[model samples]
Target: MEQSNTTLPSETWANSSQSPAPMGAPYMAAAMLLFATFLVGLVGNGLYLWVLVMKMKRTVTTIWFLHLVSCSVLFTLLIPFFTVYILLGFHWVFGTGMCKVLSACTHLGMFSSAFLLALISLDRYTFTCHPIWSRRYRTMSWAQKLVAGVWLCSFALSVPYLVFQETSELESSRITCVDYYDTSRDQDRAETQAWRQHTHVVLFLVRFLLGFLLPFCIIAGCYSQMGLKMMEKGLARSGKPFKVMVAAVVSFFFGWLPYHLYYGLTLFKDLSKSLMGICQLICIAMFCFNVCFTPILYLFVGQTFHQVLRTSLFTLVKTAFYEDLDSDGVGPDSSGRIR
Candidate 1:
């Protein structure tokens, strides 16, 4: 519920080498949250990546999803540096080059994540609702082309961040990557403000529509029809693939809706500073939760749950008590008659 205050004093702070004021408790809390998020994301996404690469065979769906999870892993790798920066009161100890790279990577991850979800939803629609037509046109090669298109689009969308990001020394002398257009000293500050207002309005509309609203509508509609089809066909309990599909779609919404809502609210100029900060923190938390929860949902939401669990447990037991079986030349099968 934190709000952002956009008004800045006319005179820019002259001193550029001063240390930032200590953030004390809030900074510590942000750091802790980032650490916890990093650990969860690393473990969960790592396991998913391992399973996808080393265990599961390639399919059209799996190919796209593998890239999606790879992007999340790359994004989460930056959490520690971000945590340190936030804990140090927003100081950017890393150089300006790192600022651009980190900012671009973060934006790329976000844009790609949303677009992948949209792509998955579209694929589901094609496969389930129009299977014959999809089979004719949606070959593995087609999927690869679509994924490539998505990444290209995402990179293009993030180009503005590369241009806009700059490291500057703040009033307290700490360096930070400031993402705002400063025109307070211009005689046409009013025009500048108006231009900013228009830009924000357009950007918000595009982001909400392309990134959130349209994708959610497509996903929801596709899943609703899919669920209805399953029910009508009396396949609800027949171990249908649609059940797993439903769970994944639902998890995607639950994980991302909060973060997007928070992002939308930042467009309001009247929002308070404290509320903006809190909302920013909450959005970050929600994003991390999305990253951590997705692999679990993917792993457990289908008929593979029991099989995977059993296989994992069996492997653990074998590794634990049979460490010497290899070196001792023991053969369990040969001596099994003792049982």
Candidate 2:
């Protein structure tokens, strides 16, 4: 019962002393997926960043995209370390500092991405429902400040990872990175166990709420209203933008929901080990795929970005980030089209 439930599958091999190679098939696949995702996400998000920051004009839309890509790129950069960790049969040769740093980065990436998606959805809702307000307030300066606050919040939430992450040398002579949340180390056994369980439950609930559930609610609410507005205004003729929006929302929903659900269920005491392993492997696959696929998902599902991408690819990248504006500054941009 001393084992942290948050410990990943790498730390759950049951026999850490034995090299994981023999039973590392699923892990090996995850490592390979991470490697491939790292390559694609790095290049794709990197190029998108270059395009947004360097080639495109500075606007609120471009600003949002720039940071989104930054998050993706930052997360993608950490993929190699994870892949190496898995390749090494989950051994923590990277030391305690790296262990803490990696955990923080992982949480930071997830938090920022989730927050950004929610913000994006809110932006769409405001633009569609309150165009005058969005236009007057959604300046580049405002957007920049808002994004800074997001990063600050994300970092704040990630602080727990740095605090709890530790590299523990197992009895098997293998070192594993894990969440050592038992703060009452000097307390009685019952007290320590209670503290650890409390910490685990609190962390899991907080992460699930902020990282997935709350954001999802915001997204669903915003998009639902937007859809109603579009339908009422007879603006659903094209179907392309609506389709893209639906696709993006659905993708985001499915992408992280199951991972959260699986981990949340793991909190229950009765779940069997075999079930946990299967769920863990599936979650890991989804996690890896999402890190690589998110930016591309936005790129392809965004009608504006997709159209520009179709025209001449990189040559037209600059146009993709441009907001659709009219002389009155309340044009298609007000419709909350993903630019």
Q: Which 10 consecutive residues of model 2 have the lowest summed lDDT?
A: 1-10
Residue range 1-339, candidate 2, lDDT tens digits: 111111122222222322353335777887787788788878877888988777656766566667766776777787776677778776768888887777777777777877877887787788887878887887778788989999999899889878776776755677767666522344569877787778878877887899889999999999889889888897742233334345545655666676677657656768776676676566666665666666566555544655654566664444345554621232234443323
Candidate 2's TM-score = 0.83
What are the models' TM-scores? 0.77, 0.83
> How much lDDT does each candidate structure score?
0.57, 0.64
User: Where in model 2 is the C-alpha error above 4 Å?
Assistant: 1-22, 181-188, 237-248, 302-310, 327-339
Candidate 2 residue pairs that clash: none
Residue 245 alpha-carbon offset, candidate 2, angstroms: 6.0
lDDT of 2 at 138: 72
- Tell me the lDDT of candidate 1: 0.57
